[model samples]
Target chain A: MDTNTLTGLKSAFQVAPSDELAKVICFALIESGEESEIALYLQQAQKTLDESESLKLAEALYQAELHETARNVLSEELLSHKILVAKCLNESGEPEQARKLYCSAIEADSSLESHALNRTFNVEVKVAQINNDDKPKLKVVEKMDLASVTDMVRYRQDTSDFSDVVGLEHIKKQISKKIIMPFQRPSLFQKFKKKVGGGVILYGPPGCGKTLLARATAGECKASFFNIEISDVLDMYIGESEQKLHTIFEKARSSTPCVLFFDEIEALAGKREHSRNSSSANVVSQFLTELDGFSQNNEGVLVLASTNVPWAVDAAFLRPGRFDRMFFVPPPDKVARKAILEHHIKGRPAESNIDFSSIASKATGYSGADLYNLVEMAADEAIDESIEAGNEVVISNQHFKNAIKEARSTTTEWLTTARNYARYANEGGRYDEVLSFLKKHGK
Target chain B: MQEHKYTMASECFHRGQIDRAIDLLRELLAEEPNSADCHGLLAGCLLEKKRLYAAEYELAIALNLEPQNALFYVLQARINLLRNKTKSALESCDEALQLEPEYLDAHLLKSDVYLVFNKYDEAKACIDIAANLQPGSVTVAHYYGEYFFAKGDIKTAEKYAVDSLSIDPQDEAANILMGKIKLRQGNLKEAEYHATFVIIQNPDSNSALRLFCDIKMRRNIILGGWWRFNAWMASLSNVQSSVVLISGYLVFMLAAQIFEDFEYLTVSSLISFAWIGLVIYSWVGIPMYYKRLRKELERFSFNPEF
Candidate 1:
């Protein structure tokens, strides 16, 4: 407190016991208004002040009172001391000093960067929160909710003919659980009894009804359905792609309870690993954010995401809540084949001699779509035969037997991929069905 | 007086040690009775450092010498915005813009001034002109993040921040901005991580420390500050600062108290505490009072409302 005591302390404890001591001394000067004396003591104080003392010193210098002296104190070159001085200078209306210290901070390290240092209170706030009276009536767009939709909706078909898909009642029930019920009464889903909206992946061989399943899922949601293809959003313009993404999400969010079906997910949701170019990476990143960016307000929209290449989405998206549910759309087993055969033969003039059950049993590995085509090809052959014989007729069992010889499933490669996926090779293959199917048939 | 072995190291700087030079100039201002060039140099240095008060002092002295220098007002405005001083910075920037509307840096500086003032629309407008002046410049991208972060869209805030960083990875403001967002998102480890880098760059970094203190406060347990490190605890923890300061002083004091008859440890601890006090407050308990206040800041979590 006295000059003699100050002198003794300066001589006795010159180097910082801790940086905090320096901070305390700076505070002492500010409170005492003894700038010259404080400066002298600061000069005499030790450089290797231990961390605590340095922090204390920094704190003192940083406070409003000692702020002016803190600038001089910061000259000590100790990183902690310097930071303290900069802050003190900033408080003491020495912004120039503060900025210099900030620059010095830049000068101190080769790596430190200043980003959005100008990042405001939160960000680019366009509209301020208005009180009830100050708030203008919002035109609550009852049409579309784009924030809930991905910018890239895989657009292939209108799905008006989408009603053709049948069978898989449980999968349909899953669609209701996964998309419909969640939208109808979102408040009912509880933890334990909770549902984390996950991205849905329909992985199956090409003709195995992946698209059909997606369509039914979309239709069942009964929300505004937008089938945004990859090409619909991505463009060459620098800002255009972002705008398109913005518009798509904006539109989707407005249409709450909307179902956006993305077919051939690999076209857009493909893993960032294979994308060597920045544009593709941008597309993926923007697309990922759009899909997952639903703030707490997005109530009605449920994304019915499907991908043949389920392995391609970014790893970040697959973490926890993004897209958790994946279904394995495999080739029809004998039972499914029989059901498919029964459905396809509904209006056909088949005689009792056809023996369709035996036909279905023979058609293992045939997907529903593939089975329908197989039967159609068989019918075509019969019609061709009848035309030559100059008679109206049914496709006989013998004719189908002949047709079966010419028919080959286009799903061999698809089965291998599906098998790999089902095995959890890319995480797309984590299903037990693929392992069992492969165990029975061999990888 | 000493022979210089490392001339390069001895040299002021490649970019120049403007602040140190300004400090020397301020010191010289006491002795020099009338030196306009010195004042101008000091102003220039202060302006370069973004220290507007000192810079303005020099500017007033310099304007008396040469009234037609448009760059001085421009620099003043730049200082104003960058320094968080609005009225003067804006007025100065406006004068600069009016004199030479096409002046690119001046325009950018005006936007910067507005941005610092939280006048986002004006800042954005200024940036619009600057963008027209220099399309896709890092400055525009930089402020783009700034405005967005201020607006509260962290996703886009991060997006623009990333964009700005991509252009100039060394941009300190962008990095700090990114670190702030990281801090707000409940990732103190990352916030501390980034702040550490920023702090290291400028030990005198007010912004970095502000961010760092905030991050440290968000932690799950006790560390740093008073009971930071001790001989026994230092063995377990790697934060060398704690190992050295918080523990070292207390140990010295306890030893001094315990061995008062011997007297060395007590005297040593007293001296250690005094040294810190002098460095901070000239032997006053200024750091103590601030500690109580800082405790409040340390408690500030990202409630979004704040």
Candidate 2:
């Protein structure tokens, strides 16, 4: 029948032969709000589909919201329905159960060739992304992969550009002798040269030059570097963290003679028991496991982590040989401060009143970050008032004084805690003067 | 009903679950003792199982049951050969040749047995005949490759080995023979990979085991200290591996007491042993290698050309 007959039949109880019959009935039921009648018709259609093994009828019934009937009708002897069930479960947030059904479906029919199964399992997706020898291992997804290792190792080996990281010459030389030289020239200290070292974590307040020192060490070392960010280090799954951890180590192994850098590293390296989120704890477990692999199943690989909150980090990370060395990238001293100030002002115009020697001495309690803030504040103040006369402002003592008055150091609480951690970390005050100054005014 | 072959020897020869199949056939053979196929298969199974005495009587019965069949004489030749009765084996081989000149398996077996008896001319002739009959057969090509390889015709040997592998990738002999060719050519990485592939595909392969172990030993010697550590890590997988490695160490230490090459040899032995353990531990986990071997075996049975 055409549209006219179908329209005419709509007012009475009539059946017609046409491709639009199901569509007409569906629209009528929806328009009349006769849900109960619609449901009955769907159930009957589903039964017929089941009896006849017709996918068309089941699909139509499913569209009609007779889900219960539709589910039964499409439940057997077809891979299409199996895939549909998996889709429904996945959409409903039952992926684990869906994975179970998907695996069973694959097993039930050996010929079930599926790419979705590969994605759901995460096996093939990782394999395709693998950049290793022929068989690119999935282990790079682990917490200790080659990307992070290369970042850390290459960074550790770099001293060319940071050869003049400005002020920490003695400290830089010390790191070079202790860490950099040892890695670069393994035969120099043959007896002490480590194989697949435990690791090291840098702990200090923000801008105390902790990151700079870490980078300086990386730059000086003769290895590849891998800088792993927190976002890339974690995942939103129960076992994904463990898998990622495994992948990380595998990746690291691929690019050996390298370092794995975890900057602001405590994100996943936090104390497991204290980890508030289960996902965070899982990631921590993966990290620790990867660390263990570093020494046991690993060699020539170094794990370098830097953290501001050293106290919040996992206790396991600090045990002997693991982070065997924790250095404090202390805030610059008067001499160091003068050097840093001079380095910043080298190319700038300075007058007779701009006494860096006095400025360095007076800025006794300021950290490196505080000094930068002071500089910025003073520059703005000088420009704001002095340049109103339409002349280029020159930095002077008055500007420094006014800026010092305006800039407040925000590292008090942090300095106090960091000092305590240093005492606990090295106890002997290897950084005695820095610790003493920090303790005097810290929280 | 399919019987599974699983005896240590049978399984090693790729007769998967064929022992159970043999046992089932044995019972069926007892029930229908005169059945031609049953008698023939029982004799073949018995010969494969290395029950030489029983195989002798069984083949005799099969021959009596069907004198005209050439396959029966081939079975008799193989069994006689396994028993070291070279003259009888040669006679059976001759009888088989008379019945069917195109029987490559018989000709191939005769060449191998003749080679064992130091009948080089006869062996070469037989091998050449088998190769001409089935140019695509890896087994025949392998024998020809072996002859040329022994005669120092490295070019001819290499070509034949390549030909054998092209026909059958999972042939342990072909893979191992090519591995040696690559080893002598100083292609250590390629050689090691090929040898390692052989061992991984067939861990219990007695023939390929020495070559595989040799390649691993060579790696440690050439690759240096870090590699020895890597091989050690690989070997720490399980008990069997631990025993072999530890024993290899003890053996190396003993050799060290007597040999000037002790230091290097001992380290090599330790690494090789470690390699075994590593191979054992990692064998199952080294996905695709053995699975591909299994697929290859499946392909052999699945003869799409037929």
Candidate 3:
């Protein structure tokens, strides 16, 4: 069979193309090592081969490290074949083509979306690496145009109220008295010349339910919620970020009884002196103007913001009528920790009497998200046990015991830094709440 | 436009906003992939973040794009030093010096590599050249302080540290050196003040944190003695520590043999037992010290003035 001429083998395969004969012809062609003849054979046989024969031949060729030949044999019309061809192209150092094929395959098949998206990202990285390796080439440089920024300001009509939140009872009460009460009774407040809408800043360690509390505040007040993403307002171009900020403020003002929530507000309102970019200072100024400028009417447009680093925010934003009410959302207490753990473990496969209270007591200093992760870690143990036992294994006290040993509170580091700020940098009693919280926690 | 972005990225890098610098460089590189300065600055930012391999890759591309750039070679030397390839790092520094013989950073980095290898004379030579090149350089003053401190000249080290701090009171490296100098001089309060100042500015500074640990250990006698002993052991390089241990063992063996020759069997056996105990403590002391240090750090309360 190895001694057979390439022309005879090609004719034999063409006369009656079977998987075995196609494999033999591919092997003979590859063994012959005639570059032009092999290229001619592949080009002529690409359209003639059926799907199954092409797939088998391509698989064999791919295993032999003939990537281009395998890619040439596979058809793009079929989704499965396109994926195989994409793999071939990626292996053959044609990542851009492979990315395009994967993208098209994702559009044609929803089930392959995640896998195709991941492959596309990997190939895109490869393309970037290749481009980085190339020598300097003179090309027309295009300026970054910010003519149309993507509006990622998510508007919510109905959201979960404070009832759905896990902990921070004092924060809820403060928000209710200072923020929710105004929206609930605007007419009564109007008689006393008290504005119904003002700014409130929720600041705390991350994963302590600041963003959730902001959402719940809007829900409790029965107002429209505009969850303003940082990307929605931040533009690389100078003045564009300020413009976007104004547009977002206008949109919120037009919708009365609306909660404009900015998560990670420090990114947008950091101290101007700390920022090297002048545009960042301009953005902060724009934010302050939107909050309480003479031309701006923020009546019925409540501004709620949350930041993990409250000390980084500009002092100007903390004045009266602009983020006037600052709430410190500390990590959950003992009782709140138990409730959070129970909430996370509610629908999971778990034993009824798992001694969550005991676990919660052990999980001191855990934030709400930390407790959720603890439950997840416990579930992972249960899953491993189930896989080993070849049956269902409900999460038990033993799993929680194992997880608690491995889990460390991420709040400790944040609190350690906050302690310094609270103790030393507590000018005007801005971090007075943090100081009290630290003392209460025996820091 | 690319130049503007590169300048912005460089400013971010100098401001210690490493992640933001990396992001801006990535965006700029996407538009201007061939910009070697962008790649070199990105590598420096990645080196600050301790992404060694990625830094090396970016630096390699940068050097490939502009083979004659001395700054990229210095960055490559930094990545090599981080990876513990001291010889490769020296070669990179030399390559940079070959391109630009008067490069101050190259001289300073070569000094750093020599200091790592305990080649004090070579380090001092590099520092002297750097000082001559730029007399007002805070970095040169800091390196001089480091060299004198390594040579155990506490008075000279303190003088250089004060000089560096006078040049720039806010310089982190100078302050760290001053803190160490004060620590060695038994001025715990002054040492702690320097450490805390740096910490308040940048909480993630490991050197400042380590200096704080030393000051706190000194203030507390029980943990302080053990912490000091462990810190002494830690200051020795792996080879140096091993040599010390082996020398101690050999001395003990010689003493035991001399005692055995005099028929002092109990004393010789007692000496052997003491040596074993010392070995055991050396093996187990570091982890225990670190555990205690962590607990102490957790319970750290601020001084009223601080």
Candidate 4:
């Protein structure tokens, strides 16, 4: 671990510039506490090392309490490195600089904004602690106020019920029985030892109205709807994501007769083994605890989650008392497709007696969104014809035919992937609904 | 504005962000549904994702809107090739070539379809035309290597594969061709090296997996046979695999009934037992192959020079 040993390790790394050799050299330098040697090694390897290798070396340096060295090793060009450098700066008591770095990284990549904002919050807290003043606390409060001003979640009180949703009568009936009835008659459910609030997961292909169904269910029960986004929970700091999740659950619990709708729930509850980092797994674990932990009462706080890929979700989330009620929101059937087409074309100028059935039959695998696109396409066709003739022309069957030729269903790919999962990985028959739909649709 | 989005979508597609490209194209198509370029680009993205039916539908629309577009015909040929309709694929390629006789992609695709049909002479003619069109193209070199390999000229194939790799070492087709050539030469280690290189970059690549299985079989006959068979099964689409399994079952049942009708009770029982054994082998083969592949990968990691 001395300078000679460091030199020997450097020579070995030079012979084989692999990650393993670089790691060995880093550990050796850290063990010897040779600051000058570590600086020299960083300066030499800066030109030769790739981004991943530099990140590794920076991580090792950070672990050894060499914050400045770690910051020097990381490149400012990469957003990922910027976050790590911000952490190093925060550790070295440069909270303001760290906050600036986080802000810049967030500006560069909006996907990292939530994580950066959480870090900035932590930095404000640190600055307050260091200054021994209440003014920093006021600044923090002002920042929180600003955040609330720009917050996306509105706690909407939608008035639309199942009547607003087109087609899927069977799904609506089931939702009414499993979710709505419990909320409407909680005391009766308690008498029967049935919980009023539990987890229900609605899974289907993209643009198949899972979110719409959740909103309708919330309206049907006359409950407050809280749409939770992934950004609302995930944080860059360790354990902060879990804490944010707990706070969300607590907020829902405080407001009874509330529906917490989480779309793309798989991002939060994906299988632990599939996660690249422990933070994601911890978030999933925290989610499970919030769902059905000891000393937790979720009555009148229904959780509705939807995902396009239910197979990617963790199995533990589907156990009884968690997301036990799994509903598959399939692509609109032929009848449903006709209804959706009619619904989309209601306000548009069109022929009075358009043959909707022929159009619907051609849109076999179209989702509600795809059908909406088809109508838009047909309207475009009509508009083009009107422009050519210098007069407004009503959309006709010919326009529909022209639109059908260009607009293809987007659900077929999802069904194809889902079919594989249902056939091979249908553990506990969780994907039985998907399998049945595929069979009936001849997918 | 739609043209800008189309350009952006094409950039995303080239950068391997296919889902993003598809989203951008869909948005553009929503605004201008009659834009054949957007539909064709979306079809290309779908083809890359292996959503063949959707890709075909989109390409058909693109062709309908612009029947004279040779690019749409080439895209159609690619979809048909993936669907295993070699004749239709050839026809589409010929149509594209007839529209634009010097089109390099159409010539290469025609060569590929001819190679699939084992028409080595036709494949060679197409490859020759392609090479003349793009003499220094890595793709043309790879196609020439494939043509030679299909013709059983291993030395020439190896030379062309080396030539292609020297020009672009990361070319997947060239690496697969080199792996196949190495396999033909009975150089199992080199073949494994080439296949593993491609598989590490793209684990979903069926050709690399097939070559890897072949190399494994050359090393150990029994386990390798199972691995090869499983790889072959996995290469098929869900519907195709199901048909294969059902046809296999029907044949087994037919053989058993014939044995019973001939009063060969022992033969019939043996046939039934053999069928059961084969089914069991197929069932367990997947997990076993994966386990063995993991061990092999671990060994490969430990000895990087290997």
Candidate 5:
């Protein structure tokens, strides 16, 4: 079209001034490189056109070789517009900027990957599907069966031994003589007509290594360790708890030399006289039956239970042939505390000059867990110091002192309650050990 | 090496084979000679056998072996109670409590002594504290019932007894207390029912048998005659009998005053002599009843029913 004809047609359309005609005039102005006229026409057309119509107009303007105007009109309002603007830029010889826009568009919306790449390629083929393994490959992962993993974890043998425990020499010795010895010398126990398998109740304050001690006992016996959580045995459905308990015991019996450990046994074996309902009473009776093993053999199944409150346990459970052997696990003594403190700080970053004895002495009635917490608090203090100094700072004696001030012993309340029982309620002198402990402490 | 014998002893004890347990515990002790648990257990056997002196010796050795043992202290308390050394028994219970404050058996034993001493307030405090500590404890509930019964709070005592029975229907102490409460309430049939139930469970329960006998004597008294005397005799505890004797002496003194006014010296003198004789009989008989009850309790392996 001649410049004279374009000017004639634009004047004719300006007189009519219809939206479609104005759009036509705008396209013509764009084709003829009439930048000022195209801007004026487009500004008027934008008010009338919707978003999609405006996009189409921008595309037409790009096809008419108005790259800058098309990019300005696109304004990233639509994904397709973005692809079009990138294409216009690439065609107009600004490939770097075009590639960046394409990459960004795909990044913003992952579903646009193939479409963005295809628009860049100007073809139907997806770049990702191309056999270009040389570029990169996603890391491959193998799926695992959860049931098998659980079985592996549940049936695994614990290799812990009494040596692994920090202290409690007397308790360890008693457990070995009563429990491990029978396992090692079955014939000796058998000749005495003693049932190889029997139950023992371990009572103490919380976090005092009761569970850890049980594992060590199992390790000492070289038995398969089956830790039965009270939650696992207690079911919401009636008779289910008994069934679960029965299954656990049967499993232990079948897996000869299995150490069936029930932590927090008081919940499972609370006094029948204290039971509020027949369901709990039934559970107790079921437990008693399992312990008796009237028809079944429990020759190598060692049932060990631990509780923080032995006084809550049923009296019948303490009778002969049941949980006859009872041991009261107390807070670690000074030597044990020292050992525990050392264990907590072994791999941690601490100063060589830090006095463990000072910390141990400060933690008079601390449990093993309490010691671990103290070390953690000290390490945290060191971290704050390190951050303030803008450099690495080792845990210092000062940090430990700070931790000591912050972390009080968790065993005090337990001991206070224990003293009451030990002092007034020690039926049959069953709490002699507790008495001896109180005496030693000058309590 | 003698572990098997020890096992045999424990098995016998659990099976209520007291004689067998005694023999095996003896044999095991002879072989090992240093087992504190064996000694303590042997003392328990002797305690059940009613051999108070032998039990005391065995318990002493056990305590010597494990001096700080709270259980041994409780056993020694029981032994003292059997010997009628109320003071010594209370001291032993205190020592046990000193060793283990929350020992339920020790608390129960202390409560029993308080009941026997007629220290109703002390008994109530001990059992109430135990009850508060372990609300659902059958032993504590039973002791609280006994405390109420001793205080003559029959209604509350019956409630506690029923509460205890609700927890453990076959509990011997609860049933015996129930029988006592029923007898006090004049529910003779209910009293007989509970007594019979307790006897079925533990025929040697002295409290139960006494309540049964008294109930029977009362029923016979309805027809009058010799049954009146026996019923009257059964009606009073040691403390009640002492009070009766004192009142009888005062009444006789008034009668003497009336007789002296009329110049009846011989009748006044006779009344004075009878009153003195009655006082002496009461002084002897009251202790004998307690002695017989304690001896009967010692004969059984179970906890002694108050």
Candidate 6:
């Protein structure tokens, strides 16, 4: 593993050499820290590796901790190389390709039956288990029927609670008391004629965990979760979109003790005045009608909608009885940022000395997703070294500092857009939370 | 006897055929619902599909079926990791290690969780245990490269990554690591070459794709917008666009100055306005042109040859 021996091995490998000799020479060059030369030699060696030899070579390199080289050595159409490449792909966050390679692997070898290798499939399998079906059976809706409301709503059992969420203590407490408490103390609320169902809108910068909070709220209340996709409700045909919205509301009512979450709610309920067409206007009207729930009891249904552009939503949706409780999900505070960093770093190997608090303090404008990406960037840096050394390298504080320099907070764009609404269009002091957040951040 | 069916199910799972895999697994489960392996496989598949609640249910069943299994705990830890429950993930990994002291995967995962907490000592301890358990494991070697890369030792990281590639040249993580190391070393061409090669091999390698894009942007800035645009337009054998644009702007400026010299203030102002309009149009139109090109590229229909 010394320099002289490594140089000799490199020379030996350069001459007419056997595969065994080449492997030893390559490994020695790697151990001796001649990376550039080794990479060049390996690239040259790849041309000589046949389909089967390539698989063996890939497997050997994989064992030696050279993941990228393992992936590169494979021929695209070769089935045997797919499994080797797929494993490498999964480790690299290219799960989509990893999945395909795994499938190819299975076709080539009936022995490698472990599904644990592919993360994407595992997610789907979990989905299948949740729905209690072998396949994701889309509910068959009889076209425009009064009794087929449940068909439009997909119910999921969520286990997320306040513990699962990072930071946002104030928002969590507020939501718990106003929304979750009603479900928790239903009989007491009923005695006061206070129905549990009403709408609340969570507006904030994107990637700040609005959807996460909504699910946690439902989980805390132990309510059935129904996530309404806007596309699913918005039909191109006339009256269909409205009918879908109506049906969704009706389904939420029937599936009482339900948290009906409308993600990106602005899309479904944008301002009617700004609409260039009548259909969107009608859809908004239908949404309002459903929120009113004139003929039905919405007692246990909690309508939770989230939007980054709260100012764009129709004014009616913000009125006293509908979406009345507006909570702004701001970017993570210092404590939240530290917690967010911890949350993202979960199960990733890093040096023990990384100062999370320092990173958190420095990352002022970063959202939850921003912090996650920061950790990922740092992890990538460590992974590269780990592969080279043939040993696990630690993610250091310096890696994080470097990553921070490269990573830009996406919140700047959201804040710029929100400032316009808060300053020029603060009708009835609706954007006070946004204005406060902007001020607090020294914007 | 059931290995073939399991393989088929795995194949289905790998092919992005989640529903098909689920169906096959369900059938296998029906035949032997009590089999811990079946439950574990089903749970794994569910986890891949992001059915956390269901995956948890299946995991619980699998764990109940085999209370002593360390793999179950590892899978549970993985699920917890996805859920962002770092403490629980670590605890699960710990439990897995306690059950089977030599469980390298569990150790690796535990190290990862510790790293997330910035408990680097604990993370390294786990990695050390894993290395001892399986000295030549690709997973271990990859983690070694990752650790060094994270520590900002690009030279050492490249060494480890190259070592890994020597073993398996097709290793995606190693390639990405090398691409990153190349970038850090200011070898933009090398980085681009690695990323471009990876993208060709696996279009779904988003990291490689991103790296490739990053290289392009960096190169573009150095190349300058005018030159980059010219280079792109050169495909159409058209240098006329740039020539005309530059000539038109110069002519407008000359005309505005001439009008000012003649004391035709209104005409000069009018000419200035027209000049401004043309500048504005180019500003808007250039971005639109790039956007269209990007959209076409995203379709994966654009040839690399172009």
lDDT of 1 at B75: 65
Winner on DockQ (3 vs 5): 3
Cα displacement (angstroms), candidate 2, residue A8, comes to: 56
Kindly report which residue stretches of model 2 are placed more than 4 angstroms away from their true locations once superposed: A1-162, A168-170, A191-193, A294-297, A419-443, B1-306
The better-scoring model by DockQ among 3 and 4 is 3
lDDT of 3 by residue, B226-261 (tens): 666776675565777899999999999999999999
Point out the higher-scoring one by lDDT: 2 or 4: 4
Displacement of the residue A45 alpha carbon in candidate 6, Å: 99
Clashes of each: 98, 55, 0, 0, 26, 80
How many Å off is the CA of A236 in candidate 1?
A: 4.0
Candidate closer to the true structure by TM-score (higher is better), 3 or 6? 3
Q: What TM-score would you give candidate 2 relative to the actual structure?
A: 0.37
TM-score of candidate 6 relative to the true fold: 0.42
In Å, residue A154's CA in model 4 sits off its true spot by 2.4
> Candidate 5's residue-wise lDDT over B1-306, tens digit each?
587888788778766677899999988888888888899888988787667788889888898889889898888999889888889999999999999898878888998898889998888788877887788977888888888888888889878887787566567788788878888888987676677666555544556766766776678855333333433554555766678767888899999889988999999888888888876766575456546533432221111110
The CA-based lDDT of model 5 is what? Answer: 0.77
Best candidate per DockQ, number?
3
Q: What DockQ values do the models have?
A: 0.01, 0.00, 0.07, 0.02, 0.01, 0.01
Ten residues in a row with the worst lDDT in model 3 chain A?
A: A141-150
What is the fnat score of candidate 2?
Answer: 0.00
Q: Is candidate 1 or candidate 4 better by lDDT?
A: 4
Model 5 residue runs over 4 Å out of place are A1-153, B1-306
Indicate whether candidate 1 or candidate 3 has the larger DockQ: 3
Model 4 off-target regions past 4 Å?
A: A1-152, B1-306
Q: For residues A361-435, what per-residue lDDT tens digits would candidate 1 score against the true structure?
A: 666566676688878987898799889999977878887788777776555545544443443243443556556
Candidates in order, TM-scores: namely: 0.37, 0.37, 0.56, 0.44, 0.42, 0.42
